[model samples]
Target: MTTISDTVALLSFLIAHPGITVAEAARATHRSPRTLVEELNGLLMCGVPPYSPSDYIGLTPLRAGDDSPIELHYASHFSRPLNFTPPEALAIKYALEHFSHGVDRETLAQISGLSAALESSLGGKAGAALRSAGRGFVLPARTERMRAMIGKLMQASEDRRVVEIEYYSSHRRRLDKRRVGVFEIIEHGAHFYVYAWCELANATRHFRLERIRSARVLDERFDRTPPERRDAGRMAPLFGGKAKERMLVRLDEHAAPDVVDDWRGVEGVKIKELPGGRAKMDMPLFNPFWALGFVMSLGEHAELLKPTSLRKELQGLLKDAIAAHA
Candidate 1:
């Protein structure tokens, strides 16, 4: 099956090598000639979101059928080469530098060459940052087993295959086996999640990748469109479902500065400053456990003002901890 990633790579290849035949494009992209033709046809409907006719990535063959060279009639945006803004250039440079650390030496060389070309092309401050960016972010290495699990889930998603997995549930604090129809893998907040239809719960759930103990792709395939995709272009939040509740907290003078510095412009978060360096914050209650941990981290300087139930739970936990220590 030609995955979305493959289709994107195919589009880039077609744009760059515009007159290549189907057979030639297949050879270059490592896809079968038949699959190449199918993907080309699929691209007819593929475009930027809010996809109108003009937003589509247009292309046509120089001659009829799949035998001839292809010609691209891309959207207006693709008409010109990309011109990266200063921040964009810096982000690209930092990404390349970070990625180079995790790749093989041969791949590292290619990344280094690409970085050099970008720096040379975009001179001055951007160019200098690319050369001296020096590890702006560091990522922990993935274990071989975790990498294999991620690869398996990705293939299952592409093929619409069912998979049985041993998952460690943080809420339950135990391992459980469940069968799921894989959808897609998504990265959020520096973590990877496999969004899938869980047979046990009979609901769509995002399973954290790191917590999956093992995965086995079954021979069975799923035929129905994923619930969120049934409406096309509509999907639930990747970090679990939408928040159904809100949290209101009061921050004392000691914690006010940190809260403002950290969440000044974050969406769904509202902060009202008061006299004497205090502030009231209102935000979505995505997870109670996370809220408890966050409030605990802030110690006595932060207080949960609303959601009486959560406030009670926090008091109980604090009492238990104090009693245990005593």
Candidate 2:
């Protein structure tokens, strides 16, 4: 999905410059040149002209004249509103009312356009109940402190500034203060992570937002690396560089789909059907830890078919488990 900021940035760029090249747009937007080219090619998606190398930027009217300011008309089907619909707007207001702290009455009125009487009628207890229910029902609590921190981090990221943070790592059971160059915030499974280049570790790492004890924007800045290089370096180790070996497993028919879906992208997976309603799958092995655990999870339904060492390791683990349990 194109984020709201991306769309706004693109619109602002067009508004600023009457004529601009793809390269120029990319530089202005802090987006990759290739991505800007792709966006230009798909101008028709937004009901704009089939943008050419020589075409002027901005929303110019669909006419032959070159003197007029661009009066761009987006098709109704293509254009989405910057403002929320009634239900969405109401939901946002209710959420903010229920969960936000450090938000005063005037600010709430400004945000929700709700009367002071109505806001007060909701009361502190009602708001607390709403918040508790929202959390119970998987609705996120939009805390003011979290929003403020995220806003600061986003501004820092756009400005290419380093952030100093006191972070707590659950895995290592340690709290450390360090400076990190923030790149992107990624949402996964109902939580957010700040994926960044950790200067202290001299590598790319993901820091969970909730786990960050405290953060402060540092005056020091660093050059942002290209996104592709960051992605490659961060993802390559999952498959163990270039020297990893491929492993194959045989599964019963009932378990095949689950296994395939679970391990879809670690490496290329090949699934084959056996004559007796069983399935065989091939996948790359980064290390024996993951493969052994995966096969053991299937109980008796899965068997390691290749790489004799892996099968032997699994045999030992299974025997140990059985002995312990017995």
Candidate 3:
């Protein structure tokens, strides 16, 4: 099935090469002629919000057959693309730079080249932001194994195959084998997760790529459709299932800025400032392991105040950690 990204890319190509034949367009897009024609027909129904007929992409073929040349009548409307504001440019530039950290050298060079092209072409406050020397975010470099695993899983997902994965379940603190009907891979915070139907859990689950010890795609096929896209404003990226519990935490002055910045646009995240630069953060707890790691990362600056059971568990973890050090 053609995704929105695929359709948009095809539209962009059509806009660039008007009156292109179906055969040539199919070759250029790496799609079969029949698939290209179907996608073009689907585009006939696509448009921005408040979608009047004029707002829809207009396509007209020169003849009645699939082999005929096609024309995009309203191509002029999309000829002028939107410009990035300064902040938008800076955000993208910074993200690109940070993304360069874990990629192969050839990919890194391409990213740098793209950054330079954007910097030189933009020319203004936006351009300056792209040209800025400092990358605003930092992340540890990823191993080649992690990169390969992600790629393999992505291909498996596209092929609608069942994959056998040896995954490390944090809650179980052990590696276990699972048969998964892979859907889509998504990046949330610093990690990549495969959203899939898990036979082991008998439900849909997100498997963190880094924690997957190994994976092998099975010859068996899956009939499951990909999940519908969640609304970004209401959902947390890392948590796919409905949250069954809530937790409250108190943050010291030093941690408040980072917490507020990270959770700013996410719905159901409430942060209220207390006196002396401190704050209270109340959020849904999807996974105890994730919550534990998050609070532990904050160290002394953050305190988990609610859910006495979890607090005791945190205390036990601290004790174990201290014992290991001793």
Candidate 4:
């Protein structure tokens, strides 16, 4: 069955390609010929407000041996691409800059040209905002090994294959192996993550690409499951799990600026005034493992104040880190 999103995309495609043949339209949409006809016919009922022939969208269906091609009409509003808002323009610019790392010269030039065009369209405040947007989510330098592993996983995702990977679990502070069914790759906060179904966990899980020690695409094919049903796409980079527990920490003046910016407007997150030059923060601990690492990153300037278990866990992590360095 064709989804609403698919139907909308199909209409847009047809509008963009006037007089497109049935088979060609189906091929472009990755839908069967019959299904494409059904969707196109169904779309004919949708219109702006009134249920009349003039208001409703119409389609000319192509039959076998018909010289005239199928044409979808009555949507001049969607004939052109949508323009981006200021925030949207800024986000697109940032994403283009971030993903330009491994792109070829021609693609890079095209991106630059698109950016210039966007800036020109979104003049005044929008253009100034785009120029002043802080550098966010900088992609880290990738080794040849990481790039090769990423390439293999991309193919595995496309082929719907299973892969065996030796991964470094930061939460566990150890290396483990698992067989994962490729779902899709998502980039966020300057890092690449794979949302996959783990046979071991028997659930959809997100794995950071850089954390994989070794990867081998297996000859096994997996039963495909959509990421939406599992909520895998909603997983945050650092945190996963129930996310019911909260962590409290105190940061000195030196570190408060960055910490506050990082946690601004977060639900259940608040900061309290402190003596001298310090503040206390209370926020949800979606993943204590990730929480511990973030706290440790603040060095001596920050201290975990509440939730004794997290403090103890950080203590143990620190002891192990010291011993490892020793």
Per-structure clash totals for the candidates: 0, 2, 0, 0
Candidate 2 has an lDDT of: 0.63
TM-score of 1: 0.60
Q: What C-alpha lDDT do the candidate models reach, one value each?
A: 0.75, 0.63, 0.78, 0.75
For model 3, give the 10-residue run with minimal summed lDDT. 230-239
Q: Report the lDDT tens digits of candidate 1 across residue range 198-287.
A: 899877777888889889889999764677442211123223344567899999999999888898876778899989999999977866
- State every prediction's TM-score relative to the real structure: 0.60, 0.45, 0.62, 0.62
Q: Candidate 3 lDDT, tens digit per residue, 1-326?
A: 65554556677788888778988888987887877787887767667778777777778743325676787855454554445668878888878977765455566678988987888899777777777757688777788777677768877888989999999988788999999988877778678877888898777788888889999999999888855763222134345434567889999999988897888766667789899889999988767887888898899999999777999999999889989999
* RMSD of each candidate relative to the true structure: 10.1, 10.6, 8.8, 8.4
Return whichever of 1 and 3 wins on TM-score: 3
Distance (Å) between predicted and true CA of 282, model 2?
1.0
Q: On TM-score, who's better, 2 or 4?
A: 4
Q: After superposition, how far is residue 191 of candidate 4 from its true place, in Å?
A: 2.0
Note the residue pairs that clash in candidate 4. Answer: none
CA lDDT of 42 in candidate 4? Answer: 76
Instruction: Locate the minimum summed-lDDT window of 10 residues in model 1.
Output: 230-239
Q: Which stretches of model 4 miss by more than 4 angstroms?
A: 1-70, 73-97, 102-140, 230-242, 275-277, 319-326
